[model samples]
Target: MSTITHRLPQKRHLVTELPGPKSVALAERRQAAVPAGLGSGVPVYAVDGDGGVLVDVDGNSLIDLGSGIAVTTVGASNAAVADAVAAQAHHLIHTCFLVTPYEGYVAVAEKLNELTPGDHEKRTALFNSGAEAVENAVKVARVATGRDAVVAFDHAYHGRTNLTMALTAKSVPYKHNFGPFAPEVYRMPMSYPYRDPLGDDGVAAARRAITAIGTQIGADGVAAVIVEPIQGEGGFVVPAPGFLPTLAQWCRANGIVFVADEVQSGFCRTGDWFACEHEGVVPDIVTTAKGIAGGMPLAGVTGRAELMDAVHPGGLGGTYSGNPVACAAALAAIDQMETLDLCARARAIGEIATSSLTATAALLAADGREVIGDIRGRGGMIAVELVRPGTSEPAPDLAKAVAAGALARGLVILTCGTYGNVIRLLPPLVIDDALLREGLAILGEVLAESA
Candidate 1:
């Protein structure tokens, strides 16, 4: 087996407090210069990172299970990506794809087209972020279908931009007071197996969503139906088995473009190239980012060639849409994912994490303290939902404590869910076995402490 080699030793070592003197000083400076709207998970500054550890400004080596919110799938500080970035930077910084075309952009587009779940002739448009990719996908759908109404799902998180904010479900931080959002976006029910009134019957859950779309919006009036194959920030809510296929078939029958928002679930993060392939359902359009460029800013919208090319010349692209450096990083990251076979790595990590979490849950239940409502997710993207003992009521407070406690103990984690009760674990795919187990053990310890 070809094991991935790390540049930095994979271990956690906290020298000073989490927000040490230097970080605290930087925080004070940030308070004056930066916007208060930006929230920090640990309030520490990072100077270096590799494998699964992020070295803070205070010299605290913390095990990184968040992966910069799943952006650094190859590794936090990938040498291949850095080399590609530097080589490209040494040539030209930006010529703007609109002004002068570059092969790096075309190469990335070709890679996305070849990898994005279908053999059909495909076209791609690159963007600077996930939100832009999603927005452009919607635009392509509307233009192709000649319809204005787009349907999004409950518990879905598309992005933070105006159109995507309309697609997102949560309000407090992502969408609160940030609208008059874009018009014509409708919310439908998602096949959230945990909380669905249909009781894990995915066919019925999908039927309800399809019925709502047909009755409320009229199938012919809808331009697109967008959903995350596995909801990320809305909680790692893996839909029941039959939900996605049913929706895809229904969209095909209705001529509505079916979009898979794979921003958080793509590039071998979920033990697959794309999460939609787990069910063998191919989307008409796909939005990808997060794990694409190994921490560089890049996103893509890939779809059927006819639909993407329907837009006239000069209809798509931005100044930095496919910056040379970003494209180079993306190519290198894709190579790393392939050479390392991170898909298999993700599945192996999933088994290890699931076993540890399941054991912890059983131990808690043995003590009559069943605070974990559920432990679910695939591959490297896993989560545990905290709930009041013996009840389904969300325990956001408990989740918050678990996160804070983990950070203090030198393990970095994150929380999500509409109710804010999910602790998501997203370790880098190249994490060493011992390091991964050690990090998960810290998580188990934190949960036990909460119990």
Candidate 2:
């Protein structure tokens, strides 16, 4: 395999204590200026990033495993993306696709329609964020199907918008005090292979969800069933093998639009273009963000042409929807993905991560420190669920400790899940294998130390 290095060198170098003096000083200003609600995972402030390393103001070069929540799949400082964005800025930054109708916007839409699963006449609309894409997808589904209710699964995270907040499963930070959310939204059981009470029978799990939807909200009343093939934020939960296909099939039979929120798992973050592709489950609408524009704020909802056209022209648009510069970045990022064959790279990254994490779990088990309850995911979008030793109970404390430990050692990592017990690893797809392994080694060592 060829090594794809970014602008920054592929190595970890910590100059001082984490949140060194400069970072600490900046923190004081941030507390006074930035709102408390805007929380950061790591305290340090990044001045530059490239390849798999984020160089902070403190001069600490931390190995990036989070990828800015899986955004920079082409690397944070990708040359192609930078060049395109710069050129676009020099030409025209924002013409507003809704008004001026730029070619860059149309180009991105065409790409999304062509790239997303299924060739059955797809249409795409670009947005500023995942939440907007999801909201628009729901709108299209409701208008197309003429149904009022939408179904979202357990542990699913759509976004922070008011409508998406209602669709989200967790409450604490995302939905707390954000009451009176959009109504007519219903929740159903997810096929959580590790934690499901019904075990890992994919078809049976699908049946359970279908039955719940029927009892709670009839099929005729439901417009869409939105799901994340690999649940993000709720934990990197990969459902049993056949769970997604069955649910999608049922949605089709019921005339409900199946929307796959691939915000975190789309692009080459997963081995496939989208996680739904792994199960051969083609969603009526697929929401994409994060990795779409190589750090530029861009998201897209690609769906069936008929459904997309069902909505009136002015019904779906935002002032900044499909910004020209972001579109240019996206086009360049897509080019990089194709030229480098990032899909194959993602699969290789997954293989390495799964093997390394599995070995770490086994070692911990042999030592009677079974904190790693599960290690699951596809491609670079992998996570390790921490639990109490020899038991299924969540070990959130251990998970936090592991993340902190890794961060302190100049290895950037992120933790997520409803229970806050999952440590998710999302290194850049173009990251060098040696650096990737180095970060994983640090994570494994941290886990061992915690045990």
lDDT of 1 by residue, 1-451 (tens): 1476788878999999877899999999999999999998777899999989999999999999999999999888899999999999999888999999989999999999999998999999999999999999999999999999999999999999999999999998999988899999999999888888876788888999999998889999999999999999999999999999999999999899999999999999999999999999999999999999999999999999999998879989999998999999999999999999999999999999999999999999999899999999999999999999989899999999999899899999999999999999999998888999999999999999986
- TM-score of every candidate relative to the true structure: 0.99, 0.99
The local distance difference test score of each candidate is 0.93, 0.93
- Window of ten residues with lowest summed lDDT in model 2: 1-10
Q: Model 1: how large is the Cα RMSD against the reference? A: 0.8
Backbone collision count in every prediction?
Answer: 0, 0
Model 2 lDDT tens row, 20-129: 99999999999999999999989999999998899999888999999999999988899999999999999998887777998999999999999999989988899999
- On lDDT, the candidate that comes out on top is 1
Output the TM-score of candidate 1.
0.99
